[model samples]
Target: MLAAAAQDADREFSFNEQEFRYIADLVKTKTGIVLADHKKNMVYSRLARRLRALRLESFEAYCSFLESGDSEDEMGMFINAITTNLTRFFREPHHFDHLAEKMSEQFGNAPTASRIRIWSAGCSSGEEPYSVAMTMAESLTRLSAYNFRILATDLDTSMVANATAGRYRLRDAEGLSKARLAKWTIQDRSRNEMTIKQGLRDLITFKQLNLLHDWPMKGKFDAIFCRNVMIYFDGPTKDRLLNRFHSCLAPGGWLYIGHSETILEQRDQLIPMGKTIYRKALR
Candidate 1:
């Protein structure tokens, strides 16, 4: 215990309980993310880089900088640091499988083209939306027939920019099947990078969005992929966010959440369709 205490004492920046609490409150107010007591070390580890980059002496100094009301850019950096982005292509294969099933149902009998909209509500680095597009491409043969589009949104501006760029390290796509990888992406074997094909990229529009704020989307979505995002929010925030998703979904549209997240509110509106999948009940 003494050795552990000594290691902690050697940390470059002094992070006190008050500073952690202040950061927690600020993050909650701004992003609806609950930083639990357990997240203190994680928060310090992440934010310490920001402190170093900004040349701030300590967490207390960083907090004061935030409080000064001129830290908008710093706030974005802070969010990007603390927000977890642990995602890969088809992190939950089941969700993509279910999406393929739904797409088949939607276009199986239709004689004419119809508009289809899907939203990847916390799209980290574009993988989720690109995966959705790939599923659509594989499921529906005639992509040109329908007005299909995907809206990918994340709170991190840098992530949004990266998503829009549509380029990723080749290793990032190792989870994808060989056929799918070749078909959907342009591989630069020499550079060890892959750029999503223009056709799939055309189907997506990337934007920076905060789920707690007013959503600018005027139309309801047929499928909403908000996986792994609600886990950070507290119970009430999660409930409210689920309710909003319920409102934003078209009747009979699907809502996919994180494997770890459960919908406890608006049961009347969102009916369980499968594991971690909910369908908006038709009125």
Candidate 2:
């Protein structure tokens, strides 16, 4: 009994049930992320860092400040803190395999005839986008004759800056093969760091984007990788975003979602190609 009382005192900030719900609602409204009752502790733990950084007293103060400002800058920091970024190079290798197949079918016959555009939505820290670039560069033998553009976007500004740097710790290079590393990456063994060779960065454009907002991109994408991002959203939010994606995709373009994200609705619009990969039915 005494230990339990003492443990309660160790909590850095007071997170009441009301505060938790308020935050959950705000996050859902702003970012389309659903925070459940079970996630109360997780929410407190993540947001506690923000409270500490601002030297604020509680979740109430943080939420109050958020409400007081229509400030996009502070809001960015809040979203950055809340959004989970768990990514590494070549994650879910099967997606890359499918991508290679799609590329072969597209470029094999009319290699130089058409331009290829790929969107790496929710591209965390550049890994997924870089992996996409590497895969395309490797697959095409007659690359010089064609044009390819990869637009990598994230809700987190810090993540966009990091992706733009194209510099990653060497330890995270595990997914890369020897030939890929030597060709596309410049490594510093002594510092335990690696930066992407300029050639790889040349193919990618890193942008900061809030998926819920109006997109500034002009052209429809041939393939869109929004992996692992929509899992946090509720059914309605997912539906809306998928519809938006359908509109953004070119005729017969592909939409690749996270392995964990299950799509139950919109079968008529997004034809399942198996493994959570879908093709926008050419309408």
Which regions of candidate 2 deviate over 4 angstroms?
1-8, 70-72, 111-113
C-alpha RMSD (angstroms) for model 2: 2.1
Please provide, for model 2 over 83-160, each residue's C-alpha lDDT reduced to its tens digit, 9 standing for 90 to 100: 889999999999999898888788867748478899999998999999999988888766656778999999888999
Highest-scoring model, lDDT: 1
Model 2 TM-score, all chains together: 0.93
Candidate 2, 280: how far from true, in Å?
1.7
Ten-residue stretch with the least lDDT total in model 1: 1-10
Which stretches in model 1 have alpha-carbon errors above 4 Å? Answer: 1-5
- Alpha-carbon lDDT, every model: 0.90, 0.88
Clashes (N, CA, C under 3 Å) per candidate = 0, 0
Provide the global lDDT of candidate 1 against the true structure: 0.90
List the RMSD of every prediction in angstroms: 1.4, 2.1
120 Cα displacement, candidate 1 (Å): 0.4
Question: Considering summed lDDT, which 10 consecutive residues are worst modelled in model 2?
Answer: 1-10
